[model samples]
Target: MGHRSVADLMTPTAITVRRATTFKEVARLLKEFDITAVPVIDEAGHPVGVVSEADLLRPRPTGGAATAEQLMTSPAVTARLEWSVVRAARVMQRHGVKRLPVVDTDGRVAGVLSRSDLIQLFLRPDHAIREEILEDVLTRTLTLAPSAITVDVEDGLVTLSGTVPRPELLPVVKRLCHGVDGVVTVDSRLTCDSADRT
Candidate 1:
């Protein structure tokens, strides 16, 4: 099965701020784009930090017009283009961040992956999900006949029926089906033809 990578969902063109950019400018960009945060980049287009709405909201010690370098969270949390959506989400959760500045192989700022980007995976079409379950899981992985399993998908939920060669393969079917990008849950009513113990 082809799982979606961060590159598939991230905004290819990201709005960024420079280290010396004024606080007002960062706030304006955020509001103009209707985004909660923007990545701070260097002259080479390498991300140095991220300036967020919360960063802008926090009162500064100078109580004057500050710059993005002063307001941004440093040692920027980032993601790579090839990272799996699941891996990107775990990184974001581990860092307690809503967005990640996406970098290229050479480490230049390419785009930005947000919580919304990750959520889009679950929005894939139901037909695609069904195809993956039937082709990738049952047919390819388990080498089961096309007629051996019946896969039904409604919204993001998957229901697997029919019979498998062994009882163990039933759970494997449910698991691999659930692992598909758009799947929300698995309702397996599969039976086993083999007289194996449960």
Candidate 2:
């Protein structure tokens, strides 16, 4: 619910390099934009690979790599603009990449997503996290009174301690709380008893 998509967080303008672009030019572009990497695109502006500062610094045999094509890591790790931020972060983690070339449906490079973009999710205020849990998770979804759960949030960490309608709803509460935006972790100390069952 209300998950942020890559399009919402990504930098709309992406810097790119052509396959034939000299390595020196690529380096200059990166420096000019103050970015760490760029997509190596085709004439159609579709990404073919990516070249990062690390790629440029790699050891080469003949006086260093000559062009972006030679230095680039092929099969660029990319994210679609519509993908949820959670999905993009998972892909980046799986591929061991710090940035992703954000693309459109036609596979044209549209933007860029960096590790820093995902970090914004964690920067949500503690009060906001608590309110979301109390309103969205408890009141709306679970149909439980706000007072049924004592939600304490500090730096995005959520602590749930109170009473639930039944033992079965205990896990449900914890799960929904974990899914709340900006929740770093959930400490559920909620109590329930069979006598409370409806």
- Candidate 1 lDDT over 166-185, as tens digits, reads 77787777778867988888
Q: What lDDT tens digits, residue by residue, belong to model 2 across residues 1-198?
A: 556789988997657889999888988999999999989999999999999999989987643448888998989989998998889999999999999999999999999999998898889999999999999999998898787678999998899988886778988888888777788899999998557445
Score each candidate by Cα lDDT: 0.88, 0.88
Q: State each model's C-alpha RMSD to the native.
A: 3.4, 2.6
Question: Which candidate number maximizes TM-score?
Answer: 2
**Whole-model lDDT, model 2:** 0.88
Residue 72, model 2: Cα distance from true site in angstroms: 0.8
What is candidate 1's CA lDDT for residue 57?
88
Clash count per candidate: 0, 0
lDDT measured at residue 149 in model 2 versus the true structure, 0 to 100: 72
